[model samples]
Target: MAPLNSHSYHKVLALLAVIVSLVVTTTHASTITRRLETIPYLDYTGIEAAAREAISDTLKRRGVDESDLIARELLGPRQLSVTVPSCKKVSKRKEWRDLRYNEKKDWIRAVKCLQTKGDYGISPISDTLYDAFTQVHQTNWTDFHGNAFFLPWHRWFVWVHAEAMEHECGYSGPHPYWDYTLDYKNPTASPIFSTDPEVGFGTHGNIPLREIGQGGYKVDNGAFANLKVNLPIPHFLTRNFSAWKDWDPERHWGTALGGSFSPEQVKIALKAETFWELEAAIDGLNLTTFNDPPVVPSPDTPAPAGIIPLAGIHNGPHFFNMGDWNGPFWLLGTDWFPAGVVAPNDPMFWPHHTNVDRTFWRWQQRPGKQWEFNGLKGANRTDDPALPTDLLPFYGLGPDVPVALTLKTENWPMCYTY
Candidate 1:
């Protein structure tokens, strides 16, 4: 069994949450807009000294840095406790490609294992993405063994990449975007929230391929928490992709980045830009919920979903039976294309999901994660980076973000250090 995650994060999460309110009561007071328009972009600036300075300066200007405000935000876990399926056992009748948790193992190899494979002939992330998305397996990591035994180890590798983005690249964002589309009533189209617009869209790939995660809205993963989906996720995970493939190209194009997006492609961001231009036309639209009240956004043609079926919440893949933990599981994007996530580069990824994060944060309105709950047996606990017990303040996050409760690849609290 995996060790309990402990209230080790309590002191820290509490420091960040500050408030216990349910509604998004404040965004009505004013519109701050995206900060990126005036912010300068450093060219391919890595997670080194110069990049650090640039991000730090920006956080300071926004007043999100290490002052009392940031300290106050680090309050408590805004997580919930929905039950996910127990997928510990794989069904033998299925092909390896059809395995229930195929995505989980594949994700470990594809995105996470790439670094190891590139450096040590032990790639996992590639095997996963190629196998699931491209439908090819037989990885270089396992050679002829066909063993996907590096689950824990590869999860470690993923944390390293997340850390590089945070520590080296000045990324202070959260992980496993809280999938908002799951809530039928809280569709992102509802104007009831106040998060970065790109939250729901996915990550913006605009960052030159060379500078993928650099210079974006920084998130603090320290407060990160996810519900379990325990199903054969690769199968279930791939379902969403399949649905996109089946969608009428003319319909769900924006939701899936489909065929209509050919010439210029469609893009939206949570940064201040969308508010000033993209959605600016809908500024005066009245909104009652994140659900389908039809707020009538600007530059609006048909509703964003048009025909793509915003009917289903944006949860990962809907199951034959909806599990309580399934929403968070899908939000985080697991075992399949787990090189972490795919939206960071896509414009709509962030705001669409920030609204999702707002939903997760709002879910705290219901009975939430039991502070004393030990979580799943053998589930990963330490993988945040720099680690709290290590006494190292996380390398990349700041302003409103802190490194105190941050965990290491082992999932334990890491203290700040170099």
Candidate 2:
């Protein structure tokens, strides 16, 4: 061996560094692949059975025949006279992982594009077209969640977002959904959090909370890492994938609280008979378990004592993705997704909510359940009927559509399916 010159030594060191980087990256990718392989794909057949059983049991208990219910034509006539788009025209939304690498990149580009456009003039807090949607959601948080408006209102909201991206950013891809159930065993390992700068939503923020004096870890990689926003003050995209044990001590904290949105839990929610029951089951308002005799309470029944309300499918992803601080100050110290009001600040909000809408759509597809929309209405959360005449507020992003028009996904304005 000859004595090495300075230049030769530096070149050797650089080559060694590149080799080490490749090894680490390859190891990480292989670990994720193995973890995902352990989880089984979603069982659609079993899910459908559970949903039907729920509706059947409800009908049996009520002493009402399904035929009579359908004949009564409870789901009212379509409000809009526009021609319903054919199957060929309808866009199909797919799970985030299902999108090809390039498709994912295109969707991400559109999102970034929307963030650069001017605000819709809806709120002073808004600084971009993207911020405008967050503003509206924050302003109408009360009306949107914990009511009959929860499902349909969000259905419309997601549609408006996709439409905005299409018209303004020229995005031609179907809106993607994050089916948390697929990653329910270990959310952190989910491919949706891929660190790939081109396709991933970015990995969990590693920034220490003390440095920022905030709960969330600022996202520092992937497509939205450079993303900025102006709602509740401007900042970079942040996420903290903390478990929910601090928030709900009764439940064991799986990674990012994956158990809350597990396939089994979703199956239980699917068994809900009415819109309200389904909403409660999915949103974690009440009804913890259905195993022992499977008692599902009507909206009128007060939540049973001693049963801790778990953050169901809808909220599980929010809490898990954004994370929360422990103890009495939890509310004061939380991330964007957990904030509930301005959750749209994070691009992950779209796919999470899209999966939510997909779940609602699945429940609606059950026989004789398409027009079976009924739930408690108003800010008081009273037991009023969720009339089709009820209006959904969209601010300036889109038209304020009636609740009726939002029931069927195939209808005009909402010409898409999961």
lDDT of 2 by residue, 297-396 (tens): 2222333232114467876777766522111122344453334366787888899989999999998888867766666664343344554434466554
RMSD of each: 21.9, 22.0
Model 1, which residues run further than 4 Å from truth? Answer: 1-242, 249-257, 260-263, 267-289, 292-418
Among these predictions, the greatest TM-score belongs to 2
TM-score of each: 0.24, 0.71
The whole-model C-alpha lDDT of candidate 1 against the native structure comes to: 0.23
lDDT of each: 0.23, 0.61
